[model samples]
Target: MQTNSSAKKSKHILGLVIVDGVGYRNFLLSDFVNQSLNTFDEVVIFSGLPSESFEMQERANVSIVELPVFQESGKTWFWRKAKEVAHMQLHKYNFAGIDYNLQKNYPITKTKRALITKMIFRITSVFHSEKWINRFYRNQVSSFKKDEVTKVYSELLKREELDLLFFTHQRPPYLAPLDYAAKKLGIKTCSFLFSWDNLPSKGRMAAPFDSFLVWSDLMKKELHFFYPETKKQPVEVVGTPQFEPYVLDRYTSSKEDFYHKFELDPDLKTICYSCGDASTSKNDPFYIEVIAKLMEQNKLIEKVNFLVRTSPAEDGSRFKEVNKRFSFIKWNYPKWELTRKDHPEPWSQRVPLPEDLKDLRSFLKYCNLNINMCSTMSLDFMLFDKPVINPTFGTGENDLYDDQKYLRYSHYERVLESGAVAIVKNEEELVREINFSLKNPEARLKEQKELLELQIGKPLKGTSQRIAENLNEFSKA
Candidate 1:
């Protein structure tokens, strides 16, 4: 555990910390860390909670630290009010039947339970937020995340003042303490593409980082389109390292091995979605019924693999808990375990995934055709010129808040417009499009070439290496 000589050259210690610390993050960090080559005297990782992978990082020239998990203080009336706010914020409409007045927009009726929840929320908001603020106290307010963060950074400075701190995502609760701490010590701070954070109340990525490294020109255009004023903020279209590994000529494992393990037919044209986040388990009205029904009924495509790799995102137990009802076997997604069993995955009410990058790439490579909603994994499919089928679910109001219309188009529009990717508006369309893409893949191949031109501006063989090159220039200073 010796520090690299490079660390001695500068008094400033580069402090790099991440926000979401579960899966592909380690691999993403590896692409950057490997490039650093132990350039920093130390690397500190900030996680909401520590996982097994966090404990095994002794050799990476870094230390993993967990931040306090924020939760509402107690079951006080005020706390309940905060919970109501969170619930309403998460759910589209009020539980109550308040839409009677706002029907132009709400348009729908509510259940008796919904009506009750709405009334409770109405009473809470009037009592807590309008008259007094303390009644709205929640985990965020109780934990004083900003203050706690300030204390953490203050102590880190006391131990060894940082010269530069790079934040993976910027939210006041997460970044405020570090921002204030770094500001106090005159440290430069920046953030990476953690995506639109709904916290901090100060606004979005266009503001936090001193500089940003965007994945594509499409993203850059959207940035300029949305916040047209702050157009001069420094940023780079450095591409994503997540895709760098996907651009290889030869994969480590044979695709046949993936099919045989799953009892999937090799002669069949496979189309699968890495199931971004299945929280409600059997929720998505389309997947549980439409997809399963189509796959089961379609004798023509029975030889074709129509699968969805459900990981542990929205609700970790999605694929494992409910999916076990279908005839399948045991094992995990990370282990490449394919089954249609009626029992639980070994994790006890949870589906498990591998916490490594190699395993993930292997998983992605196993499929001939890929489908997804909004996961960054789609970028990998685009990078390797794989056939893609994208579904624009049109998530109603939630889509409006994030300005999803403008943002998603950065990737979605370009791919769809170039005809490199197919956009299916609904489940029926998805069925038609998925089959069409497979049946006439050569046409897709031509579209894929055009898409390669739009998305991949530079003919990059190693995206990670290019990122490392950029960072090298920054570190040289």
Candidate 2:
């Protein structure tokens, strides 16, 4: 509750965060913003959309600025378009830097065009050193993009002198231009290692950052491995703020109330099946059906009830047919309401009005066994010391789905290495794993404990505090 008079004495710090999706809610729920309020005299947040969870307008010291997502223009737009052509050409040479999903999903005509363009680049690369050309092209494109970014946002940035420029996520296109603006004004910049898979699996970052804050030592290692150039810069391990609420009692619900809300039989063993997004795990409905069939046949453990929690990005309408077939299974759909159905791609501006933390806490608390197809929820369940089952089975002809291949992705590699979960490959394995988890709930107790420690690190408390302190210390320097 900062006052006008008191706010006048505070230093101004600019903060950038994307409240576009539920995945980013941790930045709002955690101590990052709260600590900014305490440490800085005045704080300005440039966000895609306002968050209901964080009522910044009510605070006297905080202000919200609606910034546009990035678009290429001026000299940069020309170079950007050219680079796209060159990149397509380089791909034909099997240079190995292209985004595979993009190529895989492209229309047949587009793929052919890309292939022809790649052949052209391959021929040119042979005569003119492919590695050097690629490096030179990257550096040039990056430089022009930065220049154009500064040109576009210079006026907005000149409004005030900021003590620190902090961007919460690295993948957003808007960050590079914003970072360019910060550099033009000589403002110190910082960014968070936003996701678990960002380093290993995700494509190139928007831009190089002055300071990098990561979730764990594992993430620090990943930053070095992927972008060794950043090794010279400061890489701070602040842990992740998403799990901070779990350490607090205020967010947890009473066991009796939690059971009653979802209409569960307290005597029955409750199993949770968390679904992934539609694009990747299109067969989630099929998997849910399998569980329903097992339950109906009484093949599973006696009196074992199943609950399905759909992905936050989806409306859960895809499961309507399955739900009608299996009226016995319970569900908890995301409560987010979208204002504009056509807000734009990436839908980063989608507003999430949810009791998400409380609900997730309850889910992990009451569910005896949790199941999903390689979801981060496994980590959440592990934090609660609950067992998890990852069913790698697919639906449809030939059992094809991108999610089947996701099990082999680098992001899930560490979790798999930890061996805390039961990776079931087929229907029989899925049933066996579920029954085993129900019968021997503590089958992987030692493994689960070790996995939690390795992934999340110990002394889970004070993650937000540490982040705040680090920001404050940097501001002073």
Candidate 3:
């Protein structure tokens, strides 16, 4: 018992990861992990499936204990993992069963072929859609999977095992169970407010930790609204982790190559339309479709250039036809560990920075303006006090859960009203909004100043330190 207790006392800090979003989570999670390694005694990673995220994860830490199917010899652990998958799969496909029963109860199965086709499609979709695959992987290994892991750590504690623990998400699909179990076992635990889904509503912002670290108030407000039940926990709103790389890249940049690469006018304004993965993407008028059609019909306008951001999984499927007529920057999603291997020096610093990125910051930074469908980039542009255009496209006639409707941009409507954004409804309106933003630059700049006022005096740095500090407090509390 003394030895076990000594072991527990010896090293007890872990940065529990819920898998990095491919490379997206790299900078964000890495900052925490690297910093934790320096500050904490132990670091544990919780990740998704191997085929999807294994390579990227192990790059950070080889000790990653994957969720259910993500383990190295996953099949060997089937019995142990099966029940976990079963429970999680039930919750994910719960809606499917309910829908299926409703359909059959209505005798819709008289068309057996349709059912077969749908089943085939669902199966196909699981592999064909990276987004769907990601969702499946996340759900299957959910935050509860952490619960099982916590049990493992607790038993190991008897053998002198345990340490600090950190959680990655905020709600239903997350690995919160691991967090709860760890807290109960007296392990230090903390959660990174990685997305808008976990935000509390206006009233639910009870503090969930001795220190809750978040990117923006969007998270705080959302957490407050949904979990108002918890008394307000100590919270710190840090700037978006994604911005760290951008800022780092910016500090070392000449930002001039953009003009040479595009071979375009030196004086025109450029607006980057960053495409984010949102439920809205699949539904609406397919962004490129509307943009291309508008450009062809003569409304895309002059003096303003648009650059489309592409993801690793994006196969010109969304933009091939559009590219035939217009040009775009194949903006690679900036990855952390991979960046060193692939792009030794990021384009952000290369001599001629990408032109279409407005001049002020990233090409997405410009004196004229920047636009996005529902991307969080739009939020970043909001930082410049410039106009960001958001065009709303409904993903479904009826929202499965309105919150499920690309809740990534929670304060979206508020930002628009705050003069930080202009919400355009369709292609025609989008073209018009873009034209208006460029033609009236001064108006947009004024609004940019307005938004900056809100950012000032906010706790915007040292999220890692704050997180470490809070984890220490939570372990005691």
Candidate 4:
């Protein structure tokens, strides 16, 4: 428990980190904690809530502090409205940074009218210019004034000389004040790009960072393409720490035990249907139905057994209607239990439990093919050299089924472009892809290789170690 003697050559190089919620603890922190502990002389975790997942070693070098979860406070709401006015002005200038691809892609009269409306925003925005807005906010509000929530961050820094401030997730507005305080104090700051879809789908970062850690070159490019201002910031490709276990040997589970646990037939080729989030893809049961229908018709049903693995954020209530009819289909709900309050919070819901780690490894190992509507599990399954099938078709319902919507998602553009997986349009194509993948498992090997190199990046093993090494080098510098 004694502190490392070599850690104190100068003022302690403390790495102050912000862990957003329960989900980050399991999915992110667990993978990177040991490395952080070893790389920094001292590590202090500023967390939104208290959880067993954040509990680290009893070593004297590590400390944990709980803080209120960042919510949209009055000050933030005012800032957001002010920024909206600024955004209106920028859009009038035909801002290249705005995510207008969706409008550009779908060219209809309505969109044209919308574009014209955005032009009108310029008139309203003229009264509240960007320069005026900045000056007003700066003169009226302080980043760490008594009424500001960021005052606590100033107090925390006053107690210790922090060398570095790192945020695991960069989009939380709550951290904006802290980042501002850090900048005023001249502390170096960095953040990890949370996910593949983050840059395109998510909002602007809470604050500009000194550096950023990305999963691959794809993400770094996304930062440049979307937020051109970030092009000058240092971006280190650390790969993704979540997939580290996929590359490790210790987390592997025996196939016999895994199949038995799931009550799956070991002889039959297993196909895992990883569900998407409820808000986006509530009709997951429809996909489940398509699989069930194919199984009933005995097309590839005899050869493949389909398993349903709901999203960690889903409670399986949406699947109840389909679940009752297709009682024969096997189900695998996420083992990570959530409280009533935790269920609604995305970050809290994403926190993986110990069992999830084992379950994921086993599912990937036993399943010969993976099926999902653009789940990150595709990357995980690819790591196991398994074929991935993305079902883009829908059941016969206008509101219920729309295949075109999934295609427009910006993140999947790269995956589809790379041809990493088979995109099945209907049941016929689904069966065809499944049979082909099972018959010729190595057919997509070339595509997977391309994805690994361009999309995921190489040296898949030891990502956590690489991240630690980079952090240590930064500290030394």
Misplaced by over 4 Å in model 3 are 1-8, 22-30, 49-163, 172-177, 200-211, 216-218, 249-252, 259-267, 283-286, 293-301, 311-316, 325-361, 366-368, 393-410, 446-461
In model 4, the number of clashes is 1
Q: How far does residue 439 in candidate 4 sit from its true spot (Å)?
A: 1.7
lDDT values for all models: 0.48, 0.69, 0.47, 0.67
lDDT of 4 at 251: 66
lDDT of 4 by residue, 1-477 (tens): 445333343445555454543325333434566677667767666665454445533357767666555445455544543444443344433332233432332234566545544543444356455454554345323522444456677666545567777777776556667777777788888787877766665434666678888888888887777556677777788887766776566567888888888888778888888898786666678888988887887888356677889977767888888888987788988875453254225435344556677788888878888888766778878878899988877543655655445555566776889888998877789888888888888888888888877766647677777777676665555
Ranked by lDDT from best down, the candidates are: 2, 4, 1, 3
What is the per-residue lDDT of model 3 for residues 1-477, given as tens digits with 9 covering 90 to 100? 567566556665454655334323433333555565565666556554233344443553325555442221232222223322222233333233222322332324546645543453345333433243334444443433545554664454333344555555543222434444455666655566664333321111111343466666655664454334333575656544544433433333344556554443557666666665433354222665566556556675574455565533233355555566555432333222221213222321111112212232455443356656655666567664567777775544544213223333334444556676777665567888877877775566666665544432233345455555556556556
How does candidate 1 score on lDDT? Answer: 0.48
Per-model TM-score, in order, reads 0.66, 0.85, 0.63, 0.83
Candidate structures ordered by TM-score, highest first? 2, 4, 1, 3
- Model 4, CA-based lDDT: 0.67
Give the TM-score (vs. native) of candidate 2: 0.85
- Return the TM-score for candidate 1, rounded to 2 decimals: 0.66
Error of 1 at 317 (Å): 4.4
Q: Give per-residue CA lDDT, model 1, range 376-402, as digits (tens).
A: 566666555567766665545533112
- Candidate 1, superposed: residue stretches over 4 Å from native: 1-12, 22-29, 38-42, 68-148, 195-203, 224-233, 247-251, 279-285, 299-302, 315-356, 391-411, 425-428, 449-461, 472-477
